[model samples]
Target: MPKNIYFIALCLLCIWGCRESASKAGANKKDSINKVVQDAAHEIAGNFSDQRSLRFSANRLDSFFTRYDSLRTFQKDLTTFYTERNYAFAWYSDSGLTEQASHLYVRLENLPEEGLNLVLPYKHTLDSLINAANTQTLEQKSETELLLTSLYFFFAQRVWAGLEESATQKIDWLMPRKKLSYSALLDSVLKQGNTANVKEPVYRQYNLLKEYLKKYKAIPASSTTISLPGNKPIRPGDTSPEIVKLRKKLFLLGDLTNAGDTSSDTYDSTLLTAVKRFQRRHGLSEDGIAGAGLIRELNIPVPQLIEKIMVNMERNRWLPTDVRGRYLAVNIPEFVLHAYYDDSLLWNMNVVVGKDVNKTVIFAGSISQVVFSPYWNVPASILKKEILPGIQKNPNYLEKNHMEWNGPDVRQKPGPWNSLGQVKFLFPNSHSIYLHDTPSKSLFQESKRAFSHGCIRVANPKFLAQYILRDDAAWTTDRINKAMASGKEQYVAVKDPIPVYITYFTAWVDRQGDLNFREDIYKRDAQLSSLLMKR
Candidate 1:
């Protein structure tokens, strides 16, 4: 019995020894994987600091473009970007690919949010490298590095550079295109390790529009469409089945802030306020009534709004990265002029732009002088079209309108009845467009105020005169008012010239952070949209 017990005990001891050995082997294997992961991470962190260890032959870049035909357009830029870094591998490290590669991948995936529908030629190859199971060492390192560089340029061009200068010129957008060195921008982004921290890449408005794009995109594609039952205007305190639809629609559009009782069909006070707000945003008369114009704006689909936002984003990309310390900005579609001092908006006012047949030119200039009680020297186009024909019809037309011939040209005497009103702000350009006041004050009361003959008509010209001369100690408020009411033409040079940008934006985010859309009265959006989509 003792011998039998010893035999069983010996077998039990052998089994325990084998189990211990197997457990140790499993532990060693896990430790090996952990070491690999740690080494890869350390190597990636070191790649940015160690330049010499991550370079490849320049010939590889030449070869990459040959294989990737779609990226061939970026060959010149990639060459310059790499030559500046001495053919260094920007995306790879000693052990594996870096974090920026992953970041760029994510950005490329979300290109639509940037309002870009670009296609990456070697995206599948990039996908394989990033999503590979083996995270220790990257294979096809040369191809991967070139692919990443090309993509970086792609993103910068699409987001920052926008369409070429020629494209904008074709569409009559003459504002100087924002210039940027992608190589330098990439260096800064790499140093920070986050693209979001870099605002210099594009105009400030681009970021704002990007936020709204994400918001609008998050809305369901199948949102409810509101339809009114009748053509009659829906006024306040009137109950109709369409009131519920209006409430829900307004709430979704961010016009109606409070979500109170959306189920109620009654057009209550809350609905009235929301309708007025909507009217103000769309540049319609704030009557607080649901009319044809209001309903048309409300029925605009979310997708169409998204497209409008995208178009403006492209336009924003064309703006310079910085505005001067003091500047004037006139948005044609908005029919508004904004004054800025040191990048802060000082004030804004309604203005009348050119009619559709006489569209205002989009360009930039400097406000070098302000002419108070200015003479209205008519342009040749106007003289041939209106003044001369009027004189032929009525021999006393020029004299009746308080005008007389100044040499070969006709001029209106400076007074309240003058076509230029009390003041005209001049910035010399070939287009001959300028900011002036109109005697027709009633035009300012209208919602759509595009009635000028190319020159912008300021609503509050006296205030503009005071603001322009505020810094000039020689010209006080009383002096400015006297000069404006003097009834004598006087040209006063601006103490300091302020830059002026005449822009066209059908959609933009206002100072209140609300997305605002205006009519494409000049019919400019369609042409720009078509160009963007074809790409």
Candidate 2:
């Protein structure tokens, strides 16, 4: 046998004996499993005289299968994975453990700091294993290598891929969760051949959130929550002690540049400017008034904001990486529709999303059609909940609303009052939700705009229509206006499919590189916050 291989066999034999002693010493359950692993390693070592034997020694790992039941849903996958790889040390070289192994171990240790819920075991031991003195001998080197690989899988599953699909569905997040191939990711890590480039492959937003996470974490935690005493908006000439408190709060939150001046209790021009900046960063009215809306945002503590940032970071992990093509994303909480072409924001406008009771689903679809002057085929739920009640109050509800029964289903005629307004962007989805124009434009002016039944209501339909049909040569400004003016329902098929995501993120970074937080209208943040608190 090769000298190092022989030495490894002797170490495994010792490990087997030590596990037996530990079992006798009442380390019962896990020590017995360790004994099985040690035995399998030794049993396979006899045939390890050549690389050929090592390459074909898959059967030896079967006895230790029960040892990994803690891996839960990943157990069977781990089995087939190890068997296919012939139980070889995945992150090791013949001489010693590879550098990528250490990189992975450190990342696992830092996972919690990156907003992960669970804490990885044996971080200190893993750090000790990389110490200079521990590597003096090759004893137990392969075992350490395998242990690190297993830990890497555990960390990647929890932190990068997020909780299972059912768990995410419970939180009402319907966006497709991203999946990662551990083997492929490790292969790329190994291919890099250096520690400098080793990183967890996640969505682009993950990196952006990390930068903001650092910024938020730098703010010191407040000792006590302070409330601004006001039932109304503070005007420019208003004088109160609350103005001084508001100034300090905005300064702490980075809305004010100077923290040195605290001499005045009046809402001066400088204070008004800072308040306006703060209001703009938030999705509130930027009218330079410290109203209840602005004050509520101001009083949110740094720690709560940090938790919000971390929770959104977890959501970022579930985002698709390839957002390069032309796409329209509607952030439900922010009430904004962003048009992006290859990661660059083409334009953005206000939008009204579903209310608390009728939440717009968080999912993706391909927008393949745009309908102009569309009829509103009211959903059955709406018909039962709204139309029936309205009919009970007034028999002329159908005539007043210009709705007629067509083959037992009620639909409104295409016109100014048609619930879908002048245009509707169709993206085939099971949820039956799409973006459409609405006659109620006043709702868009509200800071909190969750008024629709389910579909999104775009504030600027003409702007969106023009931007969407820009590529089609046949559709010109005059033609689009003429088509919209024809007072007829028209369906225009989009040449290229644009991916649209109806997302729910209460906290997100805007195009101006500013961190913005909105009201948790659907109350999803608490559910995610609970999930993230699970150790």
Candidate 3:
């Protein structure tokens, strides 16, 4: 065996023996373990890696895997990781452990802040080494080197890469997975001394949710539930004993900025504003009413909310980091379409998503075509299940609907009463789903707008169209309206296709830094929560 490798083995054996003796010592166990770690760290003598030049042997690197067999899954990655550095020690220097080493250890210890509850391999050993404060010897430095590498991989995979691509596909997430180069990321971290670059592999939302996770975790448990008197809705200026409890709940939830006089029962303007903010966050009708719905949301335990934040964090992990620049995102659960430019949300409008029976798929594509006065080509499935049956029930069903036969298929003529309204945004996919204007604008008024067959129903399609065509000076707002009202189906090719993401984020942090939660309209939260638990 190589000298450093042999030395590491001997020191580990002595440390284990001393740990056993300490376990029997009871009162002095912690002291004995600390002393043993410090002693072993000083005993092994060899030239460790320096600040500018790393000097660990590749032969000893092979022995590292043989010793830490549990981390064998990372052998290929660790090999490539070292080969990229010409067999350099990543977490140490000639003087002592590098600054990045301590930072990594602190972050690893506080993994829960990243919405993870992972029990890392050899964590106790790493803990002892980090606590020793002086890892000068080659054996200690080399062991630290390999362990840090393994832990880095573990952290990167869970916190950044998230679940495997196949696993996300099984969960019906067809969005492109964020491709990461772990070796390159580590190089940046080591060279720049900016561990913040670790966040580059995932979407920005992941870090936002991570920040909220820490805040949510620190929230004290509420022993009492906020309930309305006789389940009656309380409007502004209404007075009731329940209002007192409501104020405190809202304060703790970050809705009410001030809980002035928690004993007061009057529903003042201060409380009214908070109620509306809370309602908006919960995807409710923001009428500033303290109803049973708002009370129920307030009563939800902090731990459950924490779990929700964590679940959405996992979903954020499954997203491609390239969704930035300029894009349109439709959050299914929130029933809203958000237009973003360069990571800044420009505007948003209400949208009706697919019902549970015909659930919309989670995916991404580029909007290449916008059809004005779109003909509602009745799908074959809809034809067989709905139109054909309607025709059988009534002979004049087709004529009444302004439908005519084209070959073997049926299509509604482009008109005001057409099922697809006057416009449709197309992003061709196998699911045949797209965003289109809806005649039933009343559906958008509902709190839960999941009435579509599978495609999205945009409440403000005209405005969306104008925004999309803003770059083309010839296609003005008046031109877009004229195109829609022409009653002739016109397909306009987009000059620069905009990326569109159909995502299902039931919980997210908004631009105002306030946390928002929406209903899991398709009941996907439970399924995702189960998967996260198993992970």
Candidate 4:
């Protein structure tokens, strides 16, 4: 063969080998690109698939790259806007954007990358707002701004309402001598920006709340001693010489004698009338008896009475504002039940609360129903501890009291001797207690009676039932009595659930501004009074 021919054949073989290698390399590159595209598409769709053929003619890689670049630019711009120091510009520019971004983030959190495209705009806006808030100033802000900031922080997991409340309490504590009203103090403290971020406001609010709590706990002690002028004896019609002296001491009748009444006996009518008037004014029974009870009332110094009233007023403020409107109120200390309609007293009656061992709790609930001639399903505690033991000792005890045991449950049928009289007001509460009439009429006669087992026992329950059932046209007083006469258990559901509040109050101002003091059965007033003084 010729030398030139051999060289040309070798060159052809080399060219063929290079062409084969290039073809193999190109196939591998295509496979690698396809994998990248597939992975990216899965991430975007949040699922597995082999649908690459769907975009057979389009470049998926290029599209994904474009979106990725846009996201990166958005994040960068948000960071810059948030970090800006100018409050006005930062807030104005980022507020709307942040809200939008927050919505997007929420939408995105539940969606796959494929759905991310739908809420991309919202995500961008949220990011911008968050960044802007991060750069906000810690200096004192207006109350409105502070509130907004606090709300944002609350939603953002940066602060809690408890912390804010604690901060408010602390502020109240620190300013012991400061007479700033609660509203003013709240306004001032809340105006100081996010307390979680700004330590000063947090501390201030905390101190205020602590102070209020302390005040609520400190009750001022009063001296129970009464001073009488040498224990002089009194004559009914003869203004006793001591009475004349007391009149001078109290400055009641400036001259101590009226016209044509130089004789002590002749002036006794004026003195007795004056004493009765004083008794009524001082929340006494107005029996006009100058005995221990009346003496105690008269001896209470004016300044001390003022202090008691102030303490009670402060306590009223601590109560929830929603206590307005129609509601039934049971004053535990007074041993009385009052139904108020639009803040006006609708009904007032003597009540017997729980004894010291079984005290009535203070709470609120709605009266759901009324039971007429209702069987008393005695509580297990009472049945096992009281009734069962009594019955075991006396076999006829159950029959005598109209009670019977069905397995473990003791049922009491309505009768004259039934513990719960003819009517029972059913108010559903967590305490499982209700206000009902009791057969023990003598208990109501006592000045201070704590006789029931936690449930309130009303003196005139028939009157209460009559008042409550007034709305029901068919349920007349005669009808109620007839139902009770039948001796069968009956429940009458009320159309509207009336609000019932069982509370304890030792001191309160009457309609005529007279301060009334009731026996604190639970002794809550003393504790509450102490707390108020502490503040």
Please give each candidate's TM-score: 0.88, 0.82, 0.87, 0.55
Each model's number of backbone clashes? Answer: 0, 0, 0, 42
Question: In the order shown, what is each candidate's alpha-carbon RMSD?
Answer: 12.9, 12.7, 12.1, 24.8
Candidate 1 lDDT (Cα, 0 to 1): 0.84
Query: What's the CA error at residue 438 for candidate 2, in Å?
Result: 1.1
lDDT of 3 at 328: 93
> Which structure is stronger by lDDT: 1 or 4?
1
User: What lDDT, from 0 to 1, does candidate 3 have?
Assistant: 0.84
**Cα misplacement distance, residue 137 of candidate 3 (Å):** 3.7
Instruction: Give the lowest summed-lDDT range of ten residues in model 4.
Output: 47-56
Positional deviation of 164 in candidate 4, in angstroms? 12
Residue 209 displacement in candidate 4 (angstroms): 23
TM-score (C-alpha, index-matched) for candidate 2: 0.82
Among all windows of 10 consecutive residues in model 3, the one with the lowest summed lDDT is 43-52
lDDT of 1 by residue, 392-472 (tens): 999999989999999999999999899999999999999999999899999988889999889999999989888888789
Better TM-score candidate (2, 3): 3
**Taking the tens digit of each residue's C-alpha lDDT, what string does model 2 give over 272-380?**
8888888887888889977777777777878888888888888888877666879999999899999888878888899999989988899999888889888899899
Cα deviation at 189, candidate 1, in Å, is: 1.5
lDDT of 3 at 180: 81
Candidate 2 backbone collisions, by pair: none
